[model samples]
Target chain A: MTPTSLNHGASAARPPAAGTFRFAAHTARIPALAGVGFKHTHLDAILADPDPVGFVEVHAENYMGDGGFPHRALERVRQDFPLSLHGVCMSIGGPQPLSEDHLARFKALVDRYEPALVSEHLAWSTHDEVFMNDLLPLPYTEETLNHVCSHIDRMQDVIGRQMLLENPSTYVVFENSTLNETDFIREIVRRTGCGLLLDVNNVFVSATNHGFSPMSYLMDYPMEHVGEIHLAGHAVQEDDEGEPLLIDSHDAPVADSVWDLYSIVIRQSGPIPTLVEWDSDLPDWPILRAEAAAADRILDEAAHSFLMGKSHAVGA
Target chain B: MTKATKTAFSGAVLAGAVAAAISGAQLVTATDAAAANVKCYGVAMAGQNDCAAGPGTTCQGTSTVDYQGNAWKYVEEGSCASMELPGERMGSLEPLERDMPS
Candidate 1:
């Protein structure tokens, strides 16, 4: 389950302290530490905070402007924090072809920024040229497998970088989906050579919605390809049958169950670049930092366990 | 943790504030009054255009909704609905399925 075969040379020495992340979870060309989703609200606070968090992420659609304050702010912030460009409306899993204009704008942004990590969801958000602001689920079939893989390939070709594809939280399943979600993603990674962004909240949400095990989904997932990890909070409501339906709302702090699952993945994957994503209803700056600092504490513990050759019982 | 990091961070912070000032002056000319109270977090991403009158589907703030290119100019907190520009019949943001899908 170790993302790579790097020997850590175990020592009896314990790690420094919680919230002090010293090493990269997994080594990449752009090494990273604990990161958070970039909200314009936190610009001044982030600029002023001396202890740098690993990186900050931005929604691609937010910065598609040719010339604007967003770009100015982003370019300035990029000086201090490594950036991860996240695409909210790429619609990569849709039946329609990838939007050339969207791709061009994204490419321009990527080219200008040269971000360390760029990611899009496995869910589709656009169809027939109308942009829906939601991440819709995809049916996992051989046809979908081929279609998504080709899209990933084209994206890598145009963007000139390996983009991380994130797992989505689903409410409904298609009868035609022949492959399980994990297997579907594994095939995409195997074929496209793109990386994975394992969103633990999504796993927990979809598993609870579909009546499955989050751990089992992780077991089946191709963990080695995971370049980044996402941790967020979700809202839970009941379905028509009075069943629990989890919504991927990035409006709150990291949930307890999600933090536990993230702990399990960290032990298995040995410290990936994890991000705290809060898109809407954003809290004050210190609250979000507290969440990122909390993720840092967990990552610190996982790295300590790995370094000390202990069982994955750091937080368990 | 290192001196190098602290120095870089402070430097970035200064640069971000300075850059924000420059852009605010050059692009968002109308909102200087609003800028007095708003910080970075107060500004959401260019509020997505609800109708075709919303320009800049390709660009972020070019929406014909508010200011020509500055429809995304930071609106006073809780004042997005009141800030009206020309030819604007604003559509509401679509609500997510809290309990059930329609």
Candidate 2:
């Protein structure tokens, strides 16, 4: 279905007033083009040759430390490309209240960098005070919905910007879940006024593990509120029953099927700013650039088709 | 001893502790600047290492064990030898036998 057909309930939530925060005057909004996760090892190569890269993303937790090379490299990257601050450990879906210290650090980074887009996952990572460092899944129910919405509200209120909540790649489904993933995410957008970061590879991975249709999930997603898209590679494993299990391991190239799924999403969503994440087993700059380039081709095709369709409708 | 004499002795010990803390912080900064590229073992907190811990791990935040000796983080070159840990252990250039999961 077209994004226009989706309910725009997210608009009902209050938006931040103008001049609530000041971003760098020179920095532009992230364009509807392909971007890549920023790696420190790639700083030199990126500075030397910045092509086919529309923006760059970095994990928010990684830069939470006080000033150092991480900030230095990010500052350089920001000067050249639009930045997307992706937080991996906010534990937004956890039952406990959000961490005040983590929120303060997140806000500090946002104020310092003024990223074009900011996002976090739908999963939880912290239990009590202990952090698991992995995106753990939560059951979909009214209780969880309330908790997730409260966390997202706090996060946006602190940062003073609309943050995108990304869909997670799950290995298991909760038998007690009352709502499906799409409906759960849609409710989050409706309540929090946050946009969505539709990770197509995650859709593929979860679909493969749980035996569902990724296309159906995409169709049911709140596409109109999608602010960004993430495409990453996952590792293949086996469940106890010997069925295929997928880990959202950002250690390899995007699989062929995932590329196809991404192409489909791009075709439907037009051209949201897409990022290719390769956090581990990093390739040389050129190799990662090629992955971004691959995404660019899909985005380009989608843009071209969209323009053509617009013209055709106008002619009619 | 008289109360005045006991209080004066306590003040001296407290002052010494503060002085040591200040110098220790300065030493870390100085050594960090002087030798910034050394891979100091058993220094990283759990899930906070700069990179992989070992097999089955990928990169940052993948360490399952806290202060895993096998997981090394880059620190000042010579400072690792002086950095102290609990149980009288010190940071090592090579992975230490302590802190590994049994």
Identify the leading candidate in terms of TM-score.
2
Q: Candidate 1: what's its TM-score on chain B?
A: 0.21
In the range A178-231, model 2's lDDT, one tens digit per residue, is 999988987787677777788888899899999999888877776676778888
TM value for model 2:
0.72
Where does model 1 exceed 4 Å of error? A1-28, A310-316, B1-102
Stretches of candidate 2 exceeding 4 Å from the true structure: A1-27, A50-52, A311-316, B1-102
Q: How far out, in Å, is residue A208 in model 2?
A: 0.4
Where is the poorest 10-residue window by lDDT in model 2 chain A? A17-26
Index of the highest-lDDT prediction? 2
Candidate 1 residues A1-316, lDDT tens each? 1223321212111122311222223222444368888776688889998777889988888889777567878898899878888887878998888999999999999888878888898978788978867788888999988889889988888887678899988889999999998878877766776777889998998999999999888877766667788988878788899988787777778899999999877776667788998876769888988898888888888778788875543333
* Per-candidate total of colliding backbone pairs: 5, 1
Residue-level error in angstroms, candidate 2, position A260: 0.7
For residues B62-97, what per-residue lDDT tens digits would candidate 2 score against the true structure? Answer: 212255476668776776656566556543445655
